[model samples]
Target: MCTFRMASNSNQMPRLDLHKDSKKLSRAQLDYMRIIEQQNLERVRRLAKQRSNNIMVGCLLGFGVLGIYGYSIYSVKQEKFLDELD
Candidate 1:
């Protein structure tokens, strides 16, 4: 019986084998790492939500400006202020 000390599969994708450290780490370290990962995930979600809100506000503001501009154009067309000179 023998071993090549490496995977013999040619089509298999190689990946990081961090499970080796699982046995070496104590409970406290594992818990701390889990907490850090969770915090990072939460921070990412918060930033994503804020970004969506900002985009929504910006879109509403832009539409408001466009609507006002359109109304001004319509009002100007309805009046004969410029036509009086012609």
Candidate 2:
């Protein structure tokens, strides 16, 4: 029960024991480990891509808003509205 877990990130890998005589995994267990590792890798890759996209979008929106504010001030200055007050 991870209280701070992210909803989209969930992964579980089962524990397996090696063969006592061989000191290695059986053929099926090895295959299972490979498959699980591949799945986990794919999940990691997908999550990384998603995170990069989110960061890019957030940065673009943040910078765009800042640019908008800067332009607003520049346009207002061009109007000389404040000149009337002074």
| Best-fitting candidate, scored by TM-score | 1
TM-score for every candidate vs. truth? 0.71, 0.62
Q: Model 2: per-residue lDDT, tens digit, 25-78?
A: 577867887899999999999999999999999999999999999999998879
List the candidate 2 regions with Cα displacement exceeding 4 Å: 1-24, 81-86
In order of listing, the candidates' clash counts read: 0, 0
Q: After superposition, how far is residue 5 of candidate 2 from its true place, in Å?
A: 22
lDDT of each: 0.89, 0.83
* After superposition, candidate 1 runs with Cα above 4 Å error: 1-17
lDDT of 1 by residue, 1-86 (tens): 88668757989865535586578668998899889999999999999999999999999999999999999999988997888898
Q: Roughly what TM-score does model 2 have, to 2 decimal places? A: 0.62
